[model samples]
Target: MTKPKALLIDVTKCIGCMACYYACKEANKLPETEKVEEDLSATNYTVVKETDGVFYRKLCMHCNEPTCASVCPVKAFEKTPEGPVIYHDKKCIGCRYCIQACPFDVPAYEWKSNKPLVKKCTMCAQRQKEGKITACAEACPTGATYFGDREELLAEARKRIQENPGQYINHIYGEKEVGGTSVLIISSIPFEKFGFRADLIEKPLSDLTWEIMSKIPNYVVVSGVFLYGIYWIINRRMELSEYNKSKNRDSSEDKN
Candidate 1:
């Protein structure tokens, strides 16, 4: 039930179309960005970037073990069972910890607002609840961004990889990055050429961090007891020395 909803993006199929970007803007009813070409603003949850004849649909990765949820002190962000990381604006305290913690740098603050919620892709949770698809998925003419269960998407990715190894890099970009992502990417060229990040740890960032944190409480209790024992022993030694001195003084008085 902890499993989050995810989107599967096949960049090889994507044309440098801004339909998805415009769809997201219209759906969210966000303010326009300063750029006349494209609105890439805090309110804009989606953006398109083109380079060297390659195009990518960039937005929140929606990590499986979201760092935003873990680091948020006020519990503003939540990971839904369906697979999207949803931010509760009312709960947000304007703290930027989530922005810093996310490896994908997905959370965008509304600098224009006095109280801004961290914003990112919600995987169209509302649309899914209503039996509809996301704005981007609906708007995509080439079907680059597919909307469905994560398992089905991954299977489709594997099928593509097996069917044509030469055509694809043979890796699902989000299959298991940062503990697995709801949004998966498959590209024709090396992912790096598509502006994909090359360096990612084998384990999700949380697994490595949680493993150490899980041991901390036990260590603290054990260390506290050990220190307490040392203090008791030192006090006992002082008491014993003082008792011996009293007895020696009594003997000297008797001899006198």
Candidate 2:
């Protein structure tokens, strides 16, 4: 099996350069923007933001067990063994369930298109298959974004925090959030300061989603039966009312 890959982002090393953002746009062939986008969108899969002079990148977390994959009724979202959460456009029903289910709010819908599809960073799955690093990591001149094996990246993150105690916060974001993700981050400032969610549970959200999804078939069956029973009762009552009316008219004719 291919060892899962990951990206380790050191927030301190980021230089507020939008190299990763531009490289992603070019690699994905998205439309070029004159100004850097402030948030993720259908066209902009990734964005870099500066908060209080600290630069940080925002993109898909690519959870090991993706909630997007679990909530997609058509199975449009897939968590590949290579560490990418890939979306299949053809399989997508445009239900936008993945958008609602994603905890990170990474998935973006092409709301302007007549035939819209959800979009997000793929973690450069094709580049990984070709034994090349992701476009973002490759374009990072400061080495702010480093890509490698998931386990190795985690070790590296811990080492950085240990060696430079004053430079890092000693917590690796994405390490245990939603059951660990392919992308990790270490920073001097707390992640909450960067708008990263601090309330995320360590358990995989897909596990909870499955618990509900497993009962969906039974729910549908029961609901169908209930609705049919109501229909049958209404139809039977209408038929009996017509029959009684006809019988009364016949009795009136015989008396006359």
Candidate 3:
């Protein structure tokens, strides 16, 4: 199997130029809004933000075990072997389950579309298929966002932190959070400064959901059997009562 790809974002190197944002819009063929949006939305797949003088980019994490994929009733979201968590708009049911299930709150709905679908970054899967880098990564002038094999990116992230101990926070976000994502980050300051969820557990959210859902079938079967048993007992009692009333009338007639 081909190794999964990933992106490593070095927040210390980002300049908040918004090149990635525009590149994403062009790649996805999204029209420019009247005003530039600083947040992730249906039209904006990726965005760069500056928080307290630190710049960080936000987009889909493309998790190894995506909760969005698991929660999608129609299987609209897919985590590909190529490392992109892709969306099949044709399969979407507009249930918005993926939007609610995503821990990062990444997915957005196309409220303006007559036929809406969930929207988020696909890690430029189309471009990757054509052997091209992601539009956002390609447009990054400062090399703040670099794309490569996921394993290689992890090694590089660790190496950078080791080489310059004073320059980084020594933690690589996305390396283990939510069971490891394809997008990783190394920041000088805590990721919480960039509005990242630091409290996320290391296990995949999907696993937790699966653990609960696995027992559902058993629960349903047990409840169904119990209900059927109650119905049978009630019906039998009615039948016996009707038979007893018929025998009493027959005895009264025989006595007369």
Candidate 4:
């Protein structure tokens, strides 16, 4: 569908001011955590993560086959045709399974009260539907973040890496991870050094887990093995019992 996507984040310009976070909360009209300045709530869709000298803007990865969508028991999370993975709070049962299943750790739990909702970036779905840029992109002062088609973004990322080998970390974080995410990341320091979870696999995070438990003939294999073992044990016991009975009969006969 030539669906619109986003550029890989270049962390070079992010100064960790968190103007984007404030813009997001204001745009969404979300309440503050009030305990610390960084209290992420059900409404705070996008936030920032920082490490020694690098900063990351954490939000939904908008994965190709999102694990959150796949794991939602009632399907509260949905991937839009336009490429944004959006959440429907009304259908949500307040179950946080999506939080646990997400490898990127984007979704945040709203544990403050009853009727709390799990929240993460929607890729600014409402604005996109209305033909506008994402709030964070628009609010960014450094022109650091951008939005576009996923394919085009990856190409741009590659081009940048090729043009300036020493400038970037030479890795595009989300281009192929999780079956190709709509949101991409380009970093300055290595992503792991910047507090990104590097342990997540490149596959759709749910695929392997779902496969071993849901598909193939593992159950049949296990059942066959169990039955075979039981049968072997029973047969051995029967043979031993018969031998002992025969010995007793032979002894009695001999005695008589």
- The candidate that wins on TM-score is 1
Instruction: Give candidate 3's total backbone clashes.
Output: 0
Query: Each prediction's TM-score against the native?
Result: 0.91, 0.84, 0.88, 0.78
**Measured by TM-score, how close is model 1 to the native structure?**
0.91
Model 4: per-residue lDDT, tens digit, 108-135?
8778767788888888889888988788
Report, for every candidate in turn, its global Cα lDDT versus the true structure: 0.81, 0.93, 0.93, 0.80
lDDT by residue (1-256, candidate 1, tens digit) is 4344568898878897888887888787776666733433477788787766778877888887788988888888888888878888888888899888777767888887776767777877788778778889999999898888899899998998889888788889988877788899988877777556778775778677788889999999999999999999999999999999999999999999
Q: Write the per-residue lDDT of candidate 2 for residues 1-256, one digit (tens) a residue.
A: 8899999999999998889999999888899887878899999999999888899999999999898998898999889998999998999989998898788999999999999999999999888888899999999999999999999999999999999999999899999999999999999999999999999999998888678879999999999999999999999999999999999999999999
Q: Give the TM-score of candidate 2.
A: 0.84
Worst 10 residues of 1 by lDDT: 32-41
Candidate 3: tens digits of C-alpha lDDT, residues 175-210: 999999999999999998888999999999888878
Ranking by lDDT: 3, 2, 1, 4
Weakest 10 consecutive residues, lDDT, candidate 4?
Answer: 34-43
Alpha-carbon runs more than 4 Å astray in model 2 = 215-256
**Candidate 2 whole-model C-alpha lDDT, 0 to 1:** 0.93
User: Can you rank all candidates by TM-score, best first?
Assistant: 1, 3, 2, 4
